[model samples]
Target: MLDQLSYKDKNTFLQNVHTAAILTYLAALLLLPLILAHPLYLLGVFLIGILAVVVSDAAQECLPFLVMGIWVAVFVMILNPLLVQNGTTVLFYGPELPVIGRLRITLEAICYGATMGVRLMAIILAFALYNAIVHPDKVTGLFSRFAWKSSLVVSLATRMIPSTARDLSNAREVQQMRGVNFSSGGFRERLKKYSWLLEVLLLSSLEGSLATAEAMQARGFGSRRRTCYNRELVRPRDYLCFLSGLSALIIGVYARFAGYANFSYYPQLDTLAAASDLIWLGVIILCLLLPLILSWGWKHWPYLRSKI
Candidate 1:
């Protein structure tokens, strides 16, 4: 069942999406604040990047909820500049509200929010790619070695949401076929009508849970330690890929501290004029090109491969 929910090896579109998504997260984490001050700018970059990656991935299955989850996390955590609006300089006056009074939008707050947003987006995209590409069985197997009960619970819980959503959609279709009018109603009525669907879906899930528990108990599922298949091989390509990601992360951190890439909001000023920006930009370009460089080296030079 876990394997059935996992990405197939033939899903190159998913692989490409995963790659793009990962790169987008990494680059945005490393570059967004270097170039932009507004939280909206970071959000725009993330939206465009996600759209491009997912469209490129173009898998038959639609994971709209997962995508929505990403957005929800972003909006709640990173997009709310209101939480961190503190600086000596105020760039603009936000509209006055009854309880909040006139809000001040500071440059520092904007940059702060943008940075936070980029960081949150990075984590979300990385996990989203992992979920989209990596097999859940593989993840379960990996996690089980560390903590079996916790791993299984998390895996099951993660699987549960999608499964329930699928069941709900099917239930709605059946209700529609049975002459139930879901569309021609007020918002409250529409919601009230869906209660029937939700009830049945919950019942179905409860049954599934019972069946799964029974099947597991019968098989003595936890009596012995579970074994995992070694499907992921560590090739030279993987090492190069990992090293490149590491380099990007490190360079980003370095640039942040060194003032090559920075964010400031004080006395109504937001500028990045450090000399390190040029040097680090070159370093980032090299880091991004490392994969192609190593690939080319592998094909053309046999003796030079010792360094790789």
Candidate 2:
């Protein structure tokens, strides 16, 4: 699916950038969201996640996961308040339940849950975008330069996700053709039908694994020092991008450690009003957005040059 949607023109900055730079950029993205607890900052992270999905050309594949993330977020918002009954500002009172005495839904708990939900959604979207942009073969080849055994393991692990999804879809289509009505069935019946689907998928995976093993053996995969046919060179622009990402990561980490981006929601929601916080926020946003800017600039360089 990603192969089908990927841009035909392969001369973009993102495609040319060193894998190390890409890894650094992704690491910063994944870490910044986890460190910042402020709702506004979290919103920035969420927006970055959305931007990543759009830039990666995997929005169609990511939509379902985004919807599922929303559902999970709502579930967390509802469930957290029940489990954690802490806070002064009570919105409602509930009957005393066994094992847990009194139950009250407070504003703090709700806020905490919402923050947690947003954090989760941002992380999921970020990873989805990463998966779309970075192919398993690229990762495998990257690791192969270091350790062939590790490379093989990473290859299998990364390929398993898309392969399993594809197999499941194919299995469902074949089953439907054979008069297996998965949609129009009771809970038990649906479960049974899905079990058969899983069985078929498992068989398909085994067959693929066998074929892959045979191919690897035929190619003498581990017999010699592995060499990549297509090597990505780190250009001057790649250095600039890597340095920018590293600097952003350092600043973001410093801000987090210095408590500039900290927010509390347990007993009461607390936020810092220092001017430095806002500056750090802007820096983080720029850091997250730099790649998109570079990609778009390279994408339209010819058109921009024509005007000059």
Candidate 3:
């Protein structure tokens, strides 16, 4: 799926960064979605997420996910007002619905819903960025350094998803060539036809698993200490990145505790803690943009000398 995106193979600073640094950065990004409830802060989070997506070169792959996230936000906005009947100011009243009777939409509810929706979107985008930047193999290998057996299980599970997807696509194409119409059929007919395709997928997966087991056994996978190829060296730059991420996380946590990042949507929105928040916001923005800045600077460094 990510292969469809431009810059899938582009060498970026992030690709060379230590896995620990990436994990630290992700942890900091993940915390923002959980703590901040203000619309402005959520919007900031969303923008940072967009920046991450762009830097990771996964714009094409991110579009569908972004659309789905927007749909989810819309769904939350519509549904929240129906279920939640709190707040004083009512915008409009709707006719009594089946299960939820007497729907009353209020300004407070709408604002609250908007906050929740944007929070959801921000979280999704953050993970999408992480997925684009971090390879699963590298993650498994990192885990293997600490716990080999657990890493092996995770690696197998991760491999299964894409492998199964590929098998399904191949099965669909072969079936289509043989005039097995999966699309233009009655509901029951399509169900039966698709069931056949699923059956093929299952069989192929089982066979593949068995073969993998045989190969592992033949190679004596568990007989000795497993060695990892492609060892990543931890450079000074990686240490700097990791330290910066850790500092940001600590500061963010402190800010949250100090109520600098607090926002309320119910019973009228609370006044934004502008002074402290702006400081925290700047820190987050710097943390997020650092990777992009480094990558761009590295790419253009040689060209910079010609003009100089």
Candidate 4:
């Protein structure tokens, strides 16, 4: 059992799948409220994604993982604020464009922007967590079970983007040291900088790809039958975990839409007086963090009791 649960095996992969599946469902639930009404609910969901990313990448030693996490956070926090423009009350006057009026920053708009940001964060975190935890080769093997060529392509693509991004960053550093101004520029200048960056990155990637191709050819990459180094066994615990996560997600979503998990902001946002509503809120919070609770209890119950 210890060997089966080792980092060399499928335990981490299963955990990632469990997380991805749960987050995907959570994102779906958040999306409905965003579409129907109450954009704040959507924002709440996105906040959860940010939390997941922080926790998941807290110990990632790889440069690519760190870079991706940073990028994800920036995209959600900064870019998301620009897109959403809805609110009941206008808080402040934003800049006016040629066509758009004096943009007023309303609570609704901020909430909407927040929702968009969080949604993006959640999806990106899910993918990043999967990449961090699951072996690319194991992913390919799982894919090969269904379609070998397609699986191989997907696994390679997933691994390649981050590899290429790192190479681009390194090349940019070299160019910067050689006195190329990547930062000192207007919008057009920035575009020019990126063009140069792309050129260098493409050249580097072409060389890297040629090397990879040679390595693949030497190792019989596309041969009739390819053997994998690690074999992941799908266990009962894996199924149980997946099922529970899925069930909780589905129920939570249904409850959300059915008005059971609904929160309001018109009359009041954070006023919880009634016992029934409090009970319902408790259920929602529990479901939202069910995965976290299960993982923690399983990993630390004895230690927690000892401390107590």
- Highest TM-score model number: 3
Each candidate's lDDT (Cα)?
0.59, 0.76, 0.76, 0.54
**Residue pair clashes in candidate 1:** 108-265
TM-score of each: 0.60, 0.78, 0.84, 0.53
Candidate 1, 1-308: lDDT as tens digits:
33434565543322422243334434544364344443333454355435533533523332543465557656754445565557866777878767757777766666665556565564455445455555566556655787999988988998887788789989999999999999888999999998999899989999999999999899788888776656444445555656665676576567656666554555444554445555676675566455545545554676645444
User: What is the lDDT for 233 in model 3?
Assistant: 80
Model 3 earns a TM-score of 0.84
Best-first order by TM-score: 3, 2, 1, 4
In candidate 2, which residue pairs clash?
A: none
**Deviation from native of the Cα of residue 89 in model 3, angstroms:** 3.9
Q: Higher-TM-score candidate among 1 and 2?
A: 2
Tell me which of candidates 1 and 3 scores higher on lDDT: 3
Clashing pairs in 4: 46-118, 86-108, 86-109, 87-108, 87-109
Cα lDDT of model 4 by residue, 25-143, tens digit = 44544343343233444444445544444443423422344356557756665544455444467677778866656765566555544544554544555455444455556546666
lDDT of 3: 0.76
The global Cα lDDT (0 to 1) of model 1 is 0.59
